[model samples]
Target: MGNTQIGHTDFMSKVRLTDRYVASVSPPPGGRIEIFDDNPLGAGLILRVSQTGRKSWVVRYRNEDGEQRRFSLGLYPDVSLAEARKRCIQARLAASDGVDPAGAKRRRISERRSRIIKTFNDLSLVYFAASECGEWKPRGKRKRPSTISGEKWLWTKHIKPSLGALPLEDVTPLDIKNLLRGLVDKGQDTSANRVRAQIRQMFNYAILEAEVATANPVARVPMMGEETPRDRVLRDEEIRLVWRALGDPGSLTSAQGARRANQRVYVSRPVALAIKLLLLTLQRRHEVAGMLRTELDLDQAIWAIPGSRTKNGRTTFVPLSPGAVVLIREAIRLADAGRDHPSAFVFPARWDRDKALTPASLTRALRDVSKALFLPSLTPHDLRRTAASHMASERLGISPLVIGRILNHTSEKGGAAAVTLSTYALHDFMPEKRSALIRWDKLLSEIVSTRL
Candidate 1:
């Protein structure tokens, strides 16, 4: 036992190290201090007195690395000596077992982080960050901000509020099912599917990085039969009616009626132009949204989308119609004033000004176009399907490879152009492609010209 020197009378709450804490008494400057008895392994708390008469406790013990470790308990005069001593005892017991007191403290901190209630908002930050990490790099190692921007939109608009704060371990398949069902109820099958995918990705991250061991609950959730695309290609007469309906508010009664009413709602030209662009380009919404100024070559009449920015991860050449080019120029001319002023993206989304447009916004606009034009409930994706249908038509036929390249579809067997060199250079069949697009566009225009 050390000499029984009296501790300072004042209360203290200072800890100089883990396992060691000084009592409320702020020790006066200097030397030897009263320490707990028989602390041979340095288990008892000890306070170091400073020149200014302040004291702090430190608990000395061996660390995992076999070196001496000191743990801070609290400052003297703030943390009472008794409490500091008690903490030192606990820390000593921890250290005696070769358990680092600091490590235990870290575990407690991690546990607290885990215990934090993850509401539909809490997991969003981590979820979005993980989402951003999946984007394409500019040259190779660095990621593109546009990709980051897209993920951020989905995470913010569709994901976070939906299932952000749920405990990673607690989320279940049923929760995902319910979320899908909610999207179904909202007439957003496309968004529902997207949310489902994003959730699965988030869970995977939680499992891998956050030390959360949980099955991907969202993976098991099933979607309704049809994924609603705001760009459903209009049939010949359907296109005509849709086109005619664009100007006629009365003919849209059927589209705007009860059961399928949630498709979309719009009463503006920007919305109308958005619908037109989907058919004109036969593109996914995000593609058009992220269109850049440098991508369009008016002289060559091509709208080139870089492989990095595209969903398909390949460069795409869109043979622009004179009408299409005009529309694009108008779109560029009418760029959103607030944020999308400097960079590109044809139909920029307002919420995330940095990216072109959101999938939801495109879907919504397309749905409104269909409903307003009095066409069969169409989706943006249906534009591609419609293009496929026209290409598959018996009257005018286009080769599958050309179609595949244009739409960026991976081969069904996944071994087409890769092993077969001839298939890769098939875009030389341009006369056929041009004729087909012209026919398809005219057919669509005809479809829009129809009536009941």
Candidate 2:
């Protein structure tokens, strides 16, 4: 074989050897012929450097079965001298143990990185109800589904749309930043914050249960926490206006206003009485809405609400004041007048006589009242806030707990809702909360009595 020199002599790359080994370049390229001991049959290893500069090691040995075994230690100096030796050792050990060294190496590499990338698209396919460019968001039950529905919308509309395409592993800090920045740019601050919260929950699920290694993408997302608190309560004068607007036979807005303006606001006689009961007893809108006519004992001045209708998932009873008794009796009288439809509710729906007006109906009625002011943009929750504020300001020494109890609101300090209808027992916190309500009614009465 003719010899050809590689670039530099100092590197000792060009081979000069005798014919038994023939350590010449294989071609014009950098082929390494066998580098061996002086004799080809020596007991050491041989290295062959290829034209591509890859060097592999081969050892010639005799197996215990008296067969010849030759092992290739793999291409290198990329593999390194130490790594080649390690591979040789592993190959020798595997051959001795009757394991295929090549197969073992492949298995080790496959086990280390066996996971495939999981995109949000995969998780969403199982969870999502719609496919507006691949998201896992559920559809709205209706045009409106109580206040919780709005929270759900915030999660689906903003957060799910933004980061719902990235693979769980690819969702880095920068990805989260970009998503939130895009939301802020669109002036959806409140919605952006809500989306951030929901995304954080998704990432948390991904980490703990889904076995994805990404940290919560929204862990560091900033919030423009409330800088201005919008007032939702009806002021003293506005309370008077709401009462004045009640009972006024004009538009539904006017009629609803008159009813909501004061506590005794309702069009249907039974519904009117229910409102009166809500005011006198300070019972929640649902407790009064869901009351079966049978649950009321007018003679005993008591109303029993079953646990199924209660928010706290418990049975509670409420003592009816004289005012409460008067209201329910009036409702019964009106409901009795509809004897042709015995199944008719106390506040029967105009569209469906079998169903009682929903608890939401009262709030909707108040919104109608606000619409009389050509839509002042007040919400029904504002009315509840008004009730609380009025109790705090005017009711005689009423505790915040009493307000919570009457409203069936869960106590902020504790998990208990003070006045839920879970118990079949007749006596409950109604006496205390009712007393507070009656006091509130008197204040409202005083304002409305002036006809201002």
Candidate 3:
């Protein structure tokens, strides 16, 4: 027991606080009761209990200005006796050094809140907006519509639903690892890699450009697996099968025959011709699918792909072969005959005439035709590879550089030849490219004519 000091007529009780003793004390009748912990008699802590049985731990000390201050430690049982005593000792040390622990704690809390990014979903939008406006540095160009659409697809499908509501700062590498593992577990390695790339880009923008986060949590996450490049070039026999299947549907079985028979709805006249043109011209699937009527000059046998539509952003003038010219003319004839077809696109969508046919639609038609022929499933890209492969072979006698130019491959070599081509030889290499493609087209024609 210790001598008690009355607080302006309110009764004050003093007792030694132990784990068992603190729990037994109750509040007195009228006002709140203050029971002192008598361990450090003079400058000790107080347990204040209200009439409603609410209990709180508080420390009484002198601050830097020598002013008596009573600081609330915390509620008891939630904060045990040992923890309260330890904190009180720390507060006493801070006061001796003329430091205000209460003010410091408040500033720390305020700083933490100011730096908080509430959620990933919210931060992702901010980052995407910054990217679109060219506000993020080292990224001077605004995202194209196609690029933006792709990112939105990834975000909507994978990112938003899972980690959208979680606090950005609280997203650890383990959280990212777990999310990616779930994607890989489903045998979607390519999709998992894409998700990882999207998340890494967003976090990088937040850390480096937006300055919202101190570190990028996605920096060290390994890719799910290495991707094997597709090398599916159609052989001579396969090419013959495709030609026969598209032209003669009666040669296939009942199931495959049904797919080819319902060509009006799924496989339109222009889309079927688009596949033949892809095999003849060996252009990109999108370029062939979204061909505009104005870009073609059938009189000169040229199909010009503008810089905006090309992957490399270069104006590519494809010299159409005799075989290609025949396909395009037929496509134009069919499109002109259809009253519902839009004049802007060579291959307009069947339902929506205003919009050009999507590459996916053209690809679906090609897959159906391939399936009908009972050939290995091949994409429009494989046709391009097939053409390029034949053109580059020694039998064709075409130079590798001319083949590369025909394919419009970006030059990665840092050498004199690359420098000379980029700086001096600004020509489209039309003469060499035309020669190589003509030889390739001839070979394809012989295969289709002889084998079928």
Q: Pick the candidate with the highest lDDT.
A: 3
State the displacement of the C-alpha of residue 191, model 2, in Å, after optimal TM-score superposition: 3.8
lDDT of 1: 0.61
Per-residue error (Å), model 3, residue 379: 3.1
Residue 155 shift from truth in candidate 2, angstroms: 3.8
Error of 3 at 326 (Å): 2.7
Off by over 4 Å in 2: 1-151, 160-190, 210-213, 225-231, 243-377, 392-401, 408-428, 449-452
The reply for model 1, stretches above 4 Å from the true place, is: 1-120, 134-166, 172-196, 214-233, 247-267, 336-343, 349-355, 372-375, 411-432, 442-452
Number of backbone-clashing residue pairs for each candidate, in the order shown: 51, 15, 0
Q: All candidates' lDDT scores? A: 0.61, 0.55, 0.75
Models ranked on lDDT: 3, 1, 2
Candidate 3 overall Cα lDDT vs. reference? 0.75
Tens digit per residue, CA lDDT, model 3, 41-146: 3256888877777878888888888888777889988977787888788788888898887767655754564455568977877767766676754444566445
Q: Can you tell me which runs of candidate 3 are displaced by over 4 Å?
A: 1-119, 123-140, 164-172, 209-212, 246-266, 334-341, 350-354, 363-377, 412-416, 423-428, 450-452
TM-score of each: 0.58, 0.46, 0.62
Q: Sorted by TM-score, highest first, which candidate order results?
A: 3, 1, 2
Clash pairs for candidate 3 = none
- lDDT tens digits, residues 62-152, model 1? 7767788778787866776567668877887887778898767756755664665255455556545544575323233444555556567
